[model samples]
Target: MEDKNIFDMLENTDDELMEDFTGLCPEIDDEKFEKLFAKSEEDYKTRKAEIKRAEERYNTEGDNSVRGVERIRRPEWLRPVMMAASFVLIAGVVIGSTAMLRKDKWMTGAGTSVPEAETEDTTEEISETTEEPETAAATEEEKTVIDGSEVENITISTRWRDTVDEKIRAADDLVTMQQGFISMDYNDFIEFAADPSLDWNGPLPSDMRESEKDKIYYIRVKDEAAESIADLRTKMKDSYTDNYLDNLKDFYNNNRYYTDWAGSGFDDLNEGDMTDKTYIFLEYRGKLYVNSYVKSCAVSSGLGDSPLIIANETDTSFTAFLPHVTPNVFDYNDVSSDEPMVEIDDMYCEEVKFVLDPECNDWRIDSRIPHDSGVFGELYNRAAEE
Candidate 1:
């Protein structure tokens, strides 16, 4: 038989091959056996042609066809299996080729990749080659650390002590005493006593001795538009005295204010002398002294009884004044010890005038002397002598 005829007969045959000849005829009982066989032969020829074309492309473009060469070698009987396998194999080859082409994008190497070769040629054309390592020198500035704590000391100016003394004296002179009228112009006092130079750093003298205490009482002027300073003082005094009397009644009832002294002599004295009295004092001995004159003045002025009294006792050499005589209590603790003691610098109209003893250490003026004063008169006098 002719070679072409023999090949055609072999391609058309459906007879099952023995296990030994499995390589020659792969499909044992396939329904499309003839078609599969024909397709296999045609695929092999197409692959062979592809290999030749790829080899030519490789030579011309400096690419490779080793993968395409590998796909064509798989057997004819195993064509279905080989075709599926070839798809995976071809994909792997394409991926590998792409990676090789992009190798310089990801890796630094001794051998030139396509992109690197092109970059080298472009640089050569530009005539701007990078300098060699031995010839190159760094031009960066060195970092520095600075010490900023060595600046010069600044000088501050201060006022003389005599200037402050004069201001206090001027405030004292503003007091006026008349029949049924005891008043002080606070505005005039503040104006004269305003000393810009006074150094406010020393401790103030606490509740003063009776003799040194300012006898002139100050009344805060409440009217915002009152033109005369004297009118302001009168209004402040009237308001203060009215509130004082009301608080006194509350105190005598063994109420909130005087309740602190309940079991003491203050309790019994409140029952007798407090009746029909505008001002009552709890003396050092704890006896209540009722003032009838102040009561009459309070009634005529339409002001309530004075809740507190200011008394100068000869034995103690101290002036006693009750706080909260007005509706609001003037808190001595709120006042700074560093500030001038007698000067009413706070504009809040909250301070009640008190005469503080230099030797007194009372935390509250009514109580025993404050603990900070060293043994009261004893240590203080000795220190003064020294």
Candidate 2:
């Protein structure tokens, strides 16, 4: 028989031969089998053509590697045998894929076959074993009883109340001091004609006339207030980090009309009520003018009862909530009036937070969440609008 007749012979196999092959394969309709066989034969032909080309090329350009060894060409029968094997493999794959697709079962590539029944049983067993313990543990935990000693371990210590009070006092003191500057005003245009320290040769502005040498008036911070300023320094050093202290110093030195106050000798500058000598005002062109110094008549606010509530706490750090209320402006110059100049109903109605972090030996105010500017902000804003 011709070499090309091999495929035809397989297709027209006798009833006995087909019966033997049928036992090993899944049953398929004749039409589907014929179509699959035709595709396999076409692929085999294309592969055979490629092999023939490669053999012809090898023959034309003899290989140098086989110089000493005998060159062995492929046998003629081997081609048909390989083609038949390829056809059988293709048909087997198609049949196997179809069967697997119909059943719709998963397979692993590792080639370790597990029985379907055994795999299902193992999966169910694993799920059951994992779920049962978790349910039992949850039920037992729900039934657990915590006694007094255990409760005490979880509760905040009573000593923390004192700490909270101390924090509130410190915060109150600092905020009050900051608001003290709101009522203070300094007139930069005031020319000190009487002062020997100022050597003035420049012409005065059209709107300003220099004060008579003897007509200068003095306005000063009170003695008690000066002592409080000294005390503020001590409190700040104790309650703030060096970085925060520097920031506070810079703010006071530049903005609060207290240029020399950042230095260690600030207490010496204000000793024995010397605030009068430091602050001098003059009537310039009929306008009341104060020199470099500021005169404070403050608008202040204080925290409510139970000022601080512990928001969160740990060994090294804690956060507290501050409720501010009853904001009022107190003008010392307004002695004729009994009541405050302005009593803001809800100046600091919003809650603010203060954080304490561990300093060298004690906890110090680290930072405030939204910097609480206090009653000064309200007064300043009102003054600006007016």
Candidate 3:
């Protein structure tokens, strides 16, 4: 073929012309070219088959089936032909600079050329990025060390989690607990129990007000109740992903307690710390622990009807929006009860994405996007705009 025809064919992107480039390839001995071309074609077919199998495994078995595969070593002669074609394409690009500039950008951090001696290293580098399946997983399984013992990587079973409905239910379970519902405890789910005693104290308000008299008081959680509280904290850490857990801890660390100047607040004032800042003393078994904030005996009244709606679902992840009405919070001194605290209404609730954890085969909260309503949300949105 003529040089001009080669450039014209490449520029036009004629599919048939592009496919059989062996016609334009440099002349070589007939027998040597046939042998090399046949070998390379076989290698290409094998690589394609391996990649297809890997994708199938990934869909059925999750990420574990995506283990690295040993890339087939490309024949040496094939590289020269590819390089020649690349040069031809570059020449065409020079002739069609306007189209090239419009459609393509230079590769970032790409070096000019590789020495012939370093060709093998360059081939290996390219293979590493290739998605073609390798045979590594058959010989040895990936391992992780837990508690000083090596364990082979295993995927979570799809027995109980085969359906989309099941995944949605699991997401609801996590979101329900994350919203601080008092109905269920973490001990009911996770194996680990709460710490027996923790001498942690919350900061106190700058000054105690008369209105906080009945509102701010410490409740002594002893025996089973104290253990339950500790277990809840432990389970919360396990349930949430790193970001949400950090936010929860930051809220706890920033919270300040309020105490009355007249001393005794709750029923057993002596049992609770009466320092400048109030502290709730929890007695787990026989030991005592202090906490900054604890949920009081208040009913968790809400809009009642709310369901977790999942969106953008895939084999590995999904976005869930739990729409529920926010409960109206009454002040410490608000004695007049009028329309009631909760009403059956709809609002943007917790927005979170649940991702399938390939390691354990269970669903975990990947991320939480805060979607609040009422006064707090308005203030937050306004501030964000500013």
lDDT of 1 by residue, 1-386 (tens): 68798767555333243333566656556768777888999998987786566434423322121112122244667988867876776566556545554563455553645476776754453333222211222211111111221111111102212321232122212111113232223332110121223222212123322311222111222233432433433433322233333343343333211211112232333221331111122121322221211211111111111112122223332222221111212222122222221211121111122233334321112221111111222221222222
The reply for model 3, stretches above 4 Å from the true place, is 1-215, 224-231, 251-304, 312-316, 327-346, 356-360, 365-369, 374-386
lDDT tens digits by residue: candidate 2, 1-386: 68878757677554457667788678789999999999999999987786566444433322221132233467999999978976776566556545553343344333457688966865565445434455456455423122211111121123455654565455434433343422233222322224444322222211223442222222232223233344445556565655555565443333232222323222333212222222222222323323332222232222322223343356666544332222211111122223222223222322222344444556666543321234323322222222
Local accuracy of candidate 3 as per-residue lDDT tens digits, 225-341 = 324444534454344555554454333333323221112223333422333333333333334333322333122222122223344457887655433223212111111212122
Scanning candidate 1 in windows of ten residues, the lowest lDDT window is 297-306
In terms of lDDT, model 2 sits at 0.39
Question: In model 2, where do residues sit more than 4 Å from their true spots?
Answer: 1-161, 171-235, 249-307, 326-360, 369-386
Task: Give TM-scores for every candidate, taking all chains together and pairing residue i with residue i.
Answer: 0.13, 0.27, 0.31
Best by TM-score: 3
User: How high is the lDDT of residue 225 in model 3?
Assistant: 30
Ordered list by lDDT, greatest first:
2, 3, 1
Clashes in model 2: which pairs?
none
